[model samples]
Target: MKSRIHPVSRPVVFRDRAADSAFLARSTVDSAKFTEWEDGNTYPVVDVEISSESHPFYTGRARVLDTAGRVERFERRYGGAVRPLR
Candidate 1:
């Protein structure tokens, strides 16, 4: 196989503004800001709006819609028998 050329992967910081969380990972993304990590090393900082820390799915803050209720309402109005399909 031919030699593969890709962007250099370096240690970078991803910060979630809403949850005030940050993590260090290797990425090729560029950033203008830098922050000192626990290891006493500076890495490029990238600000993000959402992350696992603040995401509704990850934090269990998501809203569950009443879709089942809607289905039941439709069935009642249409008078359809509920059947179980194998």
Candidate 2:
């Protein structure tokens, strides 16, 4: 047991830049930015690149990437399934 071992969790806002969305929740994360929330109170704001709002899995827009024919190149380099020697 220790005194004040846990960080303080306060009302914080997490902003999703890609999706242009924001949400408020309790967090201990620190931020230098502040924004006036819908309730007319200023809270610490943390900007994030992606969240459930814009994530492919959450948005049901998942995509498969075949960059520069890498998969094809690999297949051509090592054709067919590889079996181990007995």
Candidate 3:
């Protein structure tokens, strides 16, 4: 390992704006804003729009596509073509 060549890996707080959720983890990413952590040391803080806490998939709020309804509507609007199944 080379000294002074690699970015410092330290505890960082990732804040989710929409959900107002925050979590501390170690990362090498750089940021301008800093905050004092639980250890009484200042670390960079990164603001993000989405995280696992607020993501639809993780939260089980993901929308299921209405394919059946769409197909029916399409067939009703435009006559269904008869094509041989492959």
Candidate 4:
């Protein structure tokens, strides 16, 4: 273990902008912004673009592309020959 080389980990707030959600956790990150949390204590606020609350994968809101259907439609319209793989 090194002595005093790493930044101090402290309580910080991560705010998910898309989901309007925030959570407190210890982090090595520093911020000039501050916000009062529900605990009635001020914590360094870090704005995040995406988090589990709003992410498509985590929220189950992702749109699955229908590549196979599109390919079949294209084959029907253009009659393009797709060579079978060996």
Angstrom error of the Cα, residue 33, model 1: value is 0.9
Candidate 3 to native Cα RMSD, angstroms: 3.3
How does each model score on lDDT?
0.93, 0.94, 0.89, 0.95
In candidate 4 the C-alpha lDDT for residue 83 amounts to 65
Candidate 3 local lDDT, residue 37: 71
As for TM-score, the candidate ahead, 2 or 4, is: 4
Order of the predicted models by lDDT, top scorer first: 4, 2, 1, 3
Best by TM-score: 1
How much lDDT does candidate 4 score? 0.95
lDDT, candidate 3, 2-85, per-residue tens: 889988888899989989888899999889998777788788999999999999999999999999999889788876575559
Comparing 2 and 3 on TM-score, the stronger one: 2
What stretches of model 2 exceed 4 Å from their correct place?
64-81, 84-86
lDDT (Cα, tens digit) per residue for candidate 4, span 1-86: 89999899999999999999999999999999999999999999999999999999999999999999998898998784666689
Give candidate 3 misplaced runs (Cα > 4 Å).
1-8, 81-86
Ranking by TM-score: 1, 4, 2, 3
- Pairs in clash, predicted candidate 2: none
lDDT score for candidate 1 against the true structure = 0.93
TM-score of each: 0.78, 0.74, 0.69, 0.74
Off by over 4 Å in 1: 1-4, 76-86
